[model samples]
Target: MEISVFSIQKSKADNFENEIKEYIKMSSKFAKISDLTIFNEKIAKAQSAGSESALKSYDDIYEPNLKGFCIALDEKGEKLDSIQFAKILESNSQISFFIGGAYGLSQNFKQKVDKIISLSPLTMAHKIAKLVLFEQIFRALCINANHPYHK
Candidate 1:
């Protein structure tokens, strides 16, 4: 199965970018995967401002590029544990996961996705979210392969 991660911001810190790349490399060892595609938010500011230009920019970019089974990360989404997530990953025919900008995904974007998944109830920084998500994907791969690392 092909998995893609769509995010709204670029990696700002060198350390975080390196860590993300490390996980991506580890994940690729198990199976071929694409780099996290980062989309530039038009506003380049926090979402609370709700700039029209940003909303329009997102509409033009996010949906059209997202294909296959789309999953949006939202606080209100169904919460799943690591093992269940592994099952989901193993069973998926194709998947695309979206991490919204600081303002979060728009209502229209939310409607287009197949499902909403919450990584945590507490709000997380986008950078941390990316790292944690990649780690979880790696763990899921380990579980699928029955690797000792999972234990």
Candidate 2:
């Protein structure tokens, strides 16, 4: 199975990139995984403008490569523990996870996604969300492989 993460915006912090790399390395010890692909979109000029513009930008970039099951990161989606997430990893053939831009994913993208997963109820920055998702993917791989990292 190939797991792909399509995220908007580039990683700004060096620490965030390093952390994501660490988790990717850990996950690779068990299974085949792809690097997080950033889909760059121009940010809205006005801060007051709702996230709609960014979301639309994400939709435009995201819609084409969306094959297989697309999972959107959402606050209201089903919350899965590490074990359950492992099951999802084990069951699916090709899974693509989307981390929206500053504004979050558009309703159109959300509507097309196969599943919506919430990492946490509290709003997290895009960079942090990528790190968290990477760590969770590593944790899930450990669980599936019966590795000590999970316990």
Candidate 3:
């Protein structure tokens, strides 16, 4: 399986970098995983313009990547347990997870994706959110393989 996490954030050194890499390394045992951080002048400019503009920019950037079982992480989306998340992985060989920018994903973008899930209702920094998502992905892969790590 190949898993890709696409998040709208500036790529830089972060405190969570080491742990995030560890999860990716661990998950490598199960699937090929890549973390793609996207941030350009257009996105930056739109962010300062306002929430609606920022969301539109997010949708414009992320729309092209919506393929092969896409899932968007949004606060208003459905809340799923680990087992349920694992069930999603069971049937798909390729999965792409979209994490929006400061204003979150737009309604149009959410509708374009196959599924939308909320990691938490509370807001979190992008780095922390990425770390949590990586960990859950590792756990879900373990569950699918019956590797005992999920327990």
Instruction: Using lDDT, give the best candidate's number.
Output: 3
Candidate 1: give the clashing pairs.
Answer: 47-103
Better of 2 and 3 by lDDT: 3
- Measured against the true structure, the TM-scores of the candidates, in listed sequence, are 0.86, 0.88, 0.95
Deviating ranges (above 4 Å) for candidate 2: 39-50
Candidate 3 segments exceeding 4 Å error: none
Regions of model 1 farther than 4 Å from truth: 39-53
Candidate 1 local lDDT, residue 56:
57
Q: Give per-model CA RMSD.
A: 2.4, 2.2, 1.1
User: Each prediction's Cα lDDT score?
Assistant: 0.77, 0.79, 0.91
Ranking by TM-score: 3, 2, 1
What local lDDT does model 1 show for residue 66?
76
| Candidate 3 residue lDDT tens string, 1-151 | 9999999987658738789889999999899999888999999999999998999999989998887899999878899999999999989999999998999899888888999999998888888888899999999999999998977
User: Could you give candidate 1's per-residue lDDT for residues 3-108 as a string of tens digits?
Assistant: 7887877556552777777877888867665656555544454344565556656656687867877889888899999999888888776788888776678888
* Of candidates 2 and 1, the better by lDDT: 2
TM-score, model 1 to reference? 0.86
